[model samples]
Target: MNLDHLRVQIDSLDSEIVRLLNERINVVLEIGEEKKKAGAEVYVPSRERAVFDKIRSLNSGPLPDEAAHAIYREIMSAALALETEMKIAYLGPEATFTHQAARNKFGVSVDYIATSTIGEVFDCVQNRSADYGVVPVENSTEGAVTHTFDQFATTPLKICAEAYLPISLTLLSDQPSNEVNLIFSKQEVFGQCRSWLTANMPNVKLSPVESTTKAVKLALETPGAAAIASVMASDMYDVDVLAENIQDMQGNTTRFLIIGQEYSAPTGCDKTSIVFGVKHKVGALYDALSVFKTDNINMTKIESRPSRNKAWEYYFFVDIDGHVEQPEVKRALDELQEHCTLMTILGSYPKAEI
Candidate 1:
């Protein structure tokens, strides 16, 4: 076809695309009204998962799966905004990793609140000031975020969904690499990039700060200072990227949790988290864990934190392979509860795609 003919066809296709998008949104609005009358949640994780899965399966084109997912994410995000004034609270000063994860999951169409601490993120959701909250739960290289786990020990919020964001630390600065004499970042971030810092900037002083986003702000103000943070922060703060992918481990990822008033329904492939305290006796912990083995349930992770209420007492947080509503999982937890001083089901959420 001639160039002018192709151009005309492209314009025609664009017009049709916009028309269909509006039609789809009109139906979404009708569904939203029905949901409101029935008191159903505005955001349903199971429905979101099914939509994404269907998008991937139906995609047969030059466009990549990630690209397709990103497009639909914004579409759903817009629908959610129209349905309600969705607000997401995340740990931040802005451009923080948690903030990025929240945006990645919810898209750019919703409102975002940046809080200084993980606890505040939880409080926002608990008080109904925000529709949902996002907080980092663990890093592949650094292990569990104790603060998040501790919050789960007391909060009434449930883990409705989860997201995995790859951690890519960079050296951001306005000064030349050689002129930089000090670096700033979160303590955990410093540890993640320890080897690179030792080899490249051994003489530079490392300053641990409240967050990477805050560190970027400090770097921008302080002469000869650099910050180890995400590339997104560099762009947001207009700082130069002195180094890229500086984290010690390749493919390092942080797992984040979405907290809400209720957990998601089963999606077959799911994970359930719970916290419990066992009796103070030898083999007590073993006996409690043995219930999973008896029921042939797979335990993915376990971590213990000191129960601040009592001296030397601890609570064990566990992640199991199946949903809490599964028959075997229910039976196992019932038996496991018999061996515990206290037990709480944190939530059952769909396993995040790594």
Candidate 2:
């Protein structure tokens, strides 16, 4: 076809797309009204999942699934803003990995609050100051984030969703790599990029700051300085990415949890997290865990933290492969509760999108 003919066809398609999008928005606004009247959450993960699944099934495309998903993401994001002024709290100074993950899940249309600590993220959701909060729970390479685990012990917030952010730790600096003399990053980030620092900038002074965003800020202020941070930070902080993927290990991804008042209704494919303290005695831990095996449940993760008020007492945090509302999962929890001093079902949430 001639270029002018194709251009005319494209313009006509765009007109139809705009009209259809508006129609979709009007329907979404009606949904928002009903949700508000019923006091239900407007952003339903399972419904969104169904939409994406159906879209993928119907797709016979020159366009890829990821591209289609991105398009719908922004469409839903706009609908969400029209539906409600949802606020997301995250470990921040902005542009940090937690903030990035929050944006990934909640999208950019909603407002975000930057809390100084992971605890504050919990408090914001618990106190109803924020609709949801996001915090890093674990890293693939560095292991469990203890702070997030500890917060579950006291906080009533449930894990509404989970996000897995692949860490591509970059070196952000105003100065070139050769001119850089100092490096700053969060304590955890330093460990992730330890080998890279050892091999490349052995003589440079290493400093640990509160967050990667803070590191970028410091790097921007101080000449001859570099920061280990997300590539997103480089743009937000106006620093150059001196190097990309600097972590010694490959495939470093941090798992973050979305904290909110109530656990989401069961998505057929879901994961449940729980924390419990076993009565300190021989085989107590084993007996508690054995319930999963007996019920034919698959446990995905387990980590422990000191239970604080008592000496040598600990809380065992576990992630299992089914929703708490599921019959098999409920029965397993009932059997598991028999051996614990205290137990709490933290939350059941949709698994992170692959």
Candidate with maximal lDDT = 1
Alpha carbon lDDT of each predicted model: 0.95, 0.90
TM-score list, all predictions: 0.98, 0.97
Report the Cα lDDT for candidate 1.
Answer: 0.95
TM-score, cand. 2: 0.97
Question: lDDT tens string, model 1, 261-299?
Answer: 999999988999999999999999999999999999999
Cα RMSDs, all models: 0.9, 1.1
Look at candidate 2 and tell me the lDDT of residue 65.
91
Off by over 4 Å in 2: none
Clashing pairs in 2: none
Global lDDT of model 2: 0.90
